[model samples]
Each structure stands twice: as structure tokens, then as C-alpha cells.
Target: MSQKRNIFEEVGEQKASTPTPQGGMIDQGRGGARRGIRAWLMVLFAMVVVMVVVGGLTRLTDSGLSITEWRPVTGAIPPLSEADWQAEFDKYKQIDQWAIDNQWMELADFKEIYWWEWGHRQIGRVIGLVWALGFFGFLLARQIPTGWTGRLLFIGGLGGLQGAVGWWMVASGVTSGEGVTTVASYRLATHLGLAFLILGYIAWFIMLLSRPERDLMQARRQKEAKLWGLSTGLLHLAGVQILLGALVAGIDAGRSFTDWPLMMGQFFPPEAFSISPLWKNFFENPGLVQFIHRMVGYLLFAFAIVVFLRGRKSAHGATRAAFAAAFIALSAQVVLGIYTVVTAAPWNVAIVHQVFAILVFTLILRARFLSGYPIVTSIRGA
Candidate 1:
């Protein structure tokens, strides 16, 4: 039998046993290999960025329609022999681009363009392989964080859809009767818009995974509601501008004017709606499309400035810095956009503009994210 201590006895005479310490549920399991998963995502992110640049190059080279078919699996193996190369070139000749534009291209020229398209598709395939491996590896290992299974699956689903849409975009140009040399502008816009959407989702997930769950939870309590709203609006506007930029790229609209602050030396482009139907002009008319893109870009920059000013007022030093970075990117992008226009969208300048657009987009997202989950600073601003 155990002896009980008298209430009046000296408390220090008896040693007390303490219970083992345990972390709260929020901190339990440490959110399932966040660093490992983030590393995987970073790999995927770099691949996607490469894919975008290669895609822009393919379009600029007019090589997108060179393949003429979407053999997702079989296409991975490019032509291995002279006969196979001829067969591929023969297939390309059936398209309007070959008939109307690239008839001057011999077998060697065909191979040159062929490689650009092939490399673009190969990059895409590699990206898919990487995503599948990382995602399923994490899955079978059961290392996926809570509430993340669906998010990962969503990205995979979008990848599959993007592949299908890519074929759809190519098919639009594969036809012979309509004299369609390039893919449909709207379809190109749709394909590119989906790409950006997927990129945006990946970026957001990376940001979320960067911090621990408990820290994120605690930071969420200090979310700046107004700043979040403004940034959200800015993000949407940026999306629209990106789509418009895609439309501009789709039809070589950027090369049409080659002027700044004016289109053909006028505030408005003449023959803006020259197409037979009113709606076709919006998609097919280079002047009008470029004008719309320019107008939206101006509006987006103005809105970004407004958001930046508000972001400067944030109490958190990190949040303010994030916004400043975004604003600076915006300013650079605007200058790049102007240069892209004045230079008539040369392949080099245009590709830089496109890649820089991604940078601007990512910086804005970073600012927006910090606004929602700000990093806390010490009194001395550590």
C-alpha cells in the first residue's frame, strides 16, 4: 500500500512526477515531409518554366505545326531513319503551313523546325514524367500532407487536360482547306491561359508548403483582409493581361505596329474592325488585338501601382518588401513590353518579354501570399 503525504507537511520533502510532454495536434507529424515535397515541387517548377520558354520559341519559329500530329506516346520517339524523316515531312506537307508558307523548306530546313517542336513536346513529356513520379512516389509512401492529396491530383488532372488542349490547338492549324497557317488565336490563348493557371496553382502550393502548418495557421490570424482583396483583384487583372498578351502573340499582332504610345501614329489603330463579322476582327485583326492588349497592359500597370502603394502601408516588413519587389517587376515588365512592341517582337526580345512576364506574375503572387500569411518580425526588425 502507498503512504499518503500529510497536507501540512513541507511540500519540498516530496518529489513530484511530471508527465511526458507532447506536441499539439497541429504540430504533430510535422505536416508530412514538407521540405521533401517542396523540393520536388521546385524541380517541377523549373521544368515548367523551361517548357514555357521552349513553347514561346516554337511559336516564334513557326515550328508548332511542323509535327502535324499529336502522338502522345509514339511521338516521344522521333524519326530514326531517312525514311522516317521523309514520312514526318510528308505529313507536315499536308498542312496549310507547308503549302502556303514553308514550301521553300527542304528536308534539312524541315528538320531544323522539326527539332524545335520536338524539343518543346519532349520537355512537356519530361515534366509529366517528373510530376507523376514525384506525386505517386509521395502517395505510395504516404508522405503527402493532410488535405494535399486532392490538390496534387488536381495538378495532374490539369496536366492531362493541357495535353489534350495542346492537341486541340495544333489541330486548328493542321487543316488544309481554310488557309490556316497558324493555330487559332483564341485556341492559342486558351492553351496558354491554362498553362499560366497551372503555373499559378503550383506557385501557390509551393508558397503554402514553404512554411510549417502551425506557423501558417498562426500567421493566418493576422491576415490583412483589405490587402488580400486588392492583391486578388490585381492577380485577376494580371491573368487577363496575360491572356491578352497570348492573343497578341497568337496572330503576330505585336509585330504589326512597331510603335510606342500610338498604333500606326494614331491613338487608335485604323481598320481595327476590318473583318467581315464584328467578332472575327477581335481575334483575327492584328491591330485591334494589339490595341486591346496594350490597353489592358496599361490598365494592369496602373492597378499594380495602386496595390503597391497600399502594400507599402503594411505593418509587416516582409510584406512591404514583397510588394516592392512585385512593383519593381511590374515596372520592368512595362518597359520590356514597350521594347517588345517597338522592336516588332523579334524572337529574342519577345521571348525575354514572355519569360519576364512569368517573373512578374510570380512576384505578384508572392506579395499576395505574404499579405495573407505575413512573416512576423521582432521589435528590432530581425
Candidate 2:
């Protein structure tokens, strides 16, 4: 017997649509369950990309401390006229940093750097506005998923706190005297640390939303001993290494002595621990910091190769791709660092090296996630 169509079924045909990850006519696929959050997270992550690039520019131009002011409300506007510029310069002059170090630098010269700092702040303000509008709209639109709104709110709050942290970093340099030209090394590291934190959260959210589950290759997941533990450890190790790299950059450790494998001379420089009490030098002495950073690089490369070989034997698409990407990125970063060293940290190569480090960092994360840890035997639905 044939089934009969009901009146509601007939009317429903005209209005019904396949539901999205959210209850909408959005992407309708097996993995589309969390797409709305993913799309918005992508938007937030894009802004973070903007933040990182501009932050790099701020470092390059040495404009990080030019403004000497941090009024969230009034500071949103730029110094337009000559009087305005002079007033800004005058305020900067009062700081010990200007009186001692950059005192000879002209007001016109100061303005050049000022533009970079101004642009950084202005862009941040714009990002804030965009985030506010997006966040509030999402809540009103009922487009946001259940628990993710709180998570996104936390991310937003962290971003807002970043602005104040930035000022705190800037303050440390000037506190010493009027002539201070650079931020304290530790403060610089903290600033960069938060950026890394933001990037990690963004990447994590993206991964969770975009591809919550994937089929594991039995051949790949089974073949392991220390490779799994070793690779994961190395991933974390690389993160710690990056933090040391930041310390190196902040303190101008490159100039300490740039002959790899030997700081100034000898397999291990005699003065590596010259900072007094061996442990102290690891964090303070430029020579030791650079040496430790290089050592970490060597260990990370060795670990990567081990993972590459193990994954190569398996036929998993994601695993193979991740291994290949990580290996290549790490190799490129190493080469870039070598160039940066030989050239004594020229801004161009150094900056590229830093950016590549971030890329490799992400690749390392991808490899670890695809490594098929605790749930290796779990089957994914097609």
C-alpha cells in the first residue's frame, strides 16, 4: 500500500530546510554541527592575526614606547595638527626615557615613530568595536551555541586585558630613567606570551568546531612506543623554546656572540655560567640563553625526524600531511634562524624567522592532535 501525505507535510515542504550545525540553513554536513561558532571564531582569529602582524611592526619600528600616554577614551583620536604633535612630543620629553636616551631625537623624528604606535592603538580600538558589535549581536540573534558564548566571552575579556598589559610592559622601560629606550626583557616576554596564549586559544577553538572527530588509521595509531610521548613532549618543548627565543630577542642576546655550537669560542663557552650561581644565568645571561635556545632547536629537530619516519610508514592522510608540514616548517625556521644569526639579527630575517616559528608551532599542534592519543581506537561515523 502507498503511504498518504498529510496537509502539514504538504505545507512543511514549502518552508522546511535542512538544519545547519546550528538550527539554520547553513552548512549541512556531518561535521557541520559546530559551524556557526567556528565561523565567528575564525573572524576573531583573523583579528588576532592582525594583532600579531601589527605587533611585529611595532617591534620593528621601535615605536612601542613613543606615546608615553595611555588614555583609553581620549587617546582614541590622533595628534592631527602641529600643536597637537608638539604637545605629544612635550609629554614624551618629560619622561626619563626621552631626557636621557632619545633626547637628541627631534620632534619631527619622534613623530615618525609616533605614527606606528598611533596606528597600533587605533587599530586596537577598531578591533574592540568590531568585537563588541559581533558579540552583542550574536547574543541577540540566538545564533551562538549553548556553552560557547561563555568561552568566547572569556576570550574577549582576555583580549581587553591585553591592552592594559601592553601599557604595563611599556611602563617598565621608562621607570628606570628618562633615557630608557627599551622595555624590560621580562615584561617584553610577558607581552609576547599573551599573544601566544591568544593564538593557541583561537586555534584550539577552530579545531574543536571544524573537525570534532576523524577516523583513525589503525596502522598509524598502533605503531608507537616513545614516539607518541616523545613527540608530544617535544611539542611542549618547542613552546618553551619559543619563550626563550622571546627572551633572547628582548635582551638583544644575538649580539652576545653569534657563533653557533660555540658562544664565543670552545664547545661550551667558559663564561656560560658567568652570571653567578649557575641557574641564574639560564634566565639572565645572554650567552647562556642563546646557547640553551640553540640546544632546544637541535633536540626539537631530532624529535621531529623520529615522528616523520614513524608517520611515513603509515597511510593516514592527516598524519602524513601534518608530519610533512611540521617537518618542512621546522626546517625552514631553522634555516631562517641561521641566517638571522649570521647577519646578527637583521630585522628582515629575524622577523621572518619569528613568524615561521609561529607557523611551526601550529604545525606541531596539528601533528600532536592527529597522533591519536587516548581515543585512538574510537571509530568515527561516516
Candidate 3:
């Protein structure tokens, strides 16, 4: 009984002698707020994809220059009255697209092309709105992670720059006389390239956020160096193929040849070097441009085969599976390219071809990521 009276006092004295724990607050590793931000970025990514597809369609239908002016704010609202519609049509008549290619287009016919262009631009505006709202909301709430603020802001800036580039691309055709009814091929390529760049950046950010920082750091030690490097090369080669596709579409090169595994009944088109001023053949010459595109596609497929074989030997099951999936996509894309050439690039088939290109591009990125941070799996086998 006498010892019990002093026991509680002795324990308290012992605890007070130990040192206090250091550090103010523990890092939770980008838990809740970062997850929310990732979801928001995903939404933005989807919108950008739609924007690219619509942009492609606009070009496909020769509807890109329907709107002659680039009124960023005022253009959001389409014509509201009969008089307004006429005024819009009046502006279109001033361009060579109307004077040459669409001279027979009445007001009703004009509306079809007009709406396509309008919808494409409208999507751009909405994307900007989404980025601004999400960025500021995260900023105010302190939701963005420490190193991510700059990355996000860079995306928003790119979005803004994309708008200006869109206008610049549009202006190229608007200023051209009746001789040129479409935007400059190089400008179109620039616009398309920037769109993909933004898409890729957002995709990378999403992947980075998928794992905790400490885990990624630890995984870096076991990264498959050769596979990672090969996948990176594949990524860049796919990018070049995409830009070439844009050039093909720009000059309607895809529609110039309807033969597969050969062009104009030859492995190479007979007139591949026909364009004068030499360099213009790469951009403006339909035969040469399509030939380059087809040759590059073959080379890309061959390199992808090499990369896939290496990827199959990776220790991680998921890494092997990702490369398998990428190979599948590459095979499908090659088949689609043949069909596109055989059919002369019909809108239905051509759009599918374009979409599959995007899919292949993304799968390469996925495979690249898996090579760097492989998913480990346990097996019960000897």
C-alpha cells in the first residue's frame, strides 16, 4: 500500500527525462489534396484530347477557316440573329475559301462548315476556363503540392500560347489569296505539334502524381536502364511520325496515293522529288510527303519490334505486359495506315487512323513509365 502511493509519481518522472520527438508535422506524401488535383487535371486532359480530334476533323472537312476573325472573348457567342448570320457569312466571302473552293455554298451550306470551326474554337475556350478555374481553386485552397505549382502554371501558360498559335495558324490562310485555300502546312504542323506537346506534358504530370515521391525514388534504383532508353527513343520516333502525318494531312497527301506497301505502283512514288525549290517537297509536295510518311512508319515499326523484344525480358510482369500492349497498338496502327492509304484517306477511316496514332503515342509513354517504375509481382513457382 505504501509503494502504490508513490508508483504514479515515479512513472511521470521517468517519462519527463526522455527527449521530445523532433519535426513539427509529418509529411503525408501528397495524399488527399494532390489526388483531387490529379482528378482535375484528368478532366482537362480529356478536353484537350477532344480539342485535338475536333481540330483534325475541322481540317479534314476544309472547315478550319470558316471564321475569319479571332475574337477570343467576343467570339465565344456565335451569331444570334439573321443579320448576325449574314454578317458572318459576309466575312467568309472575303476569303479565298469562298471565292474558289466554296463559291457555290449558300448561307445554309456555309453554316455547316461554320459550326465545325465554331465548335472547335469553343472547345479551346472551355479548356482555358477549366485550367484557370482549377489552378486558382487549388492555389487558394493550398491544395497543390510543393513542386507541382510551377508545372501546373506552365500548362496554363501553354494553353494560352496555344490559343495565340491557333489564331496565327488561321491567319495564314485568311491572308492568302485564292491560290491558297488552306492554312500553311508548316503552321498547321506547328499548331498540331503544340497540342500534342501540351497533351504529353499533362499526361506526364498525371503519371508522376500516380505514385508517392518516396516510392518513386526507391523504384528509380531498380529501373530497367536499356528498356527505358529504348522506350524513350520510341516516344520520339512516334512524335516524328505524328508530325509527318500532320504534313500529309496538310497537303492532302494521304489522298494522293491509294496503294499500300507501295506508292503509285512502286516502292517509292515515281515523282517523289518532283517539287521544285527542293525543301518544299517535304511539306508541299503530296507525293514526296506521303512517301516520307510511309517510309518513316515502316522504320518506326521495325524499331518498336526491337524495343518490345527487350521489354519482354524485363523482370517485372507488369513491365512485360505494358510493352506487349504497346506492341499490339503499334501493329494495329500499321494496319490502319495501310487501309488509309488503300482507301485514299476517307474521313471515317482517316479519323480512326488519327485516333489510333494518339493511342499508340500514349501507350509508348505508358511503357516508358513502367520501365522506370516497374510493378513487382510475386509468383508461386520454382
RMSD of each: 2.7, 6.2, 3.7
**Top-lDDT structure, candidate number:** 1
RMSD of 2: 6.2
List TM-score per model, in order.
0.95, 0.81, 0.92
lDDT of 2 at 209: 62
> Can you rank all candidates by lDDT, best first?
1, 3, 2
- TM value for model 3: 0.92
Worst 10 residues of 1 by lDDT: 11-20
lDDT of each: 0.92, 0.73, 0.89
Candidate order by TM-score, decreasing, is: 1, 3, 2
**lDDT of candidate 2 over 1-382, digit per residue (tens):** 9667775675546424656454522332333236766777778777777776677678777888888878888998888898999999888777776767677889888988888888888877777787787778777877665556777787788788888888898887655444467787677777777877777787777765654433223334454545556567767877887887888887788767777656676766567778778777777788778887888888888877887787675445566677788889998888878777777997777778778877888777766666643233334521
lDDT, model 2, position 56: 69
Candidate 2 least-lDDT 10 residues: 24-33
Please, what are the lDDT tens digits per residue for candidate 1 over residues 1-382?
9888898899666456755568778967657778998898888888888888999999999999999888999999999999999999999999889899989999999999999999999988998999999999999999999889899889889988988999999899998868989999899999888988889999999999999899999999999999999999998999899989999999999999998898889999999989988999889899999999989989999999999999999989999999999999989999999999998889999999999989988999999999999998888976
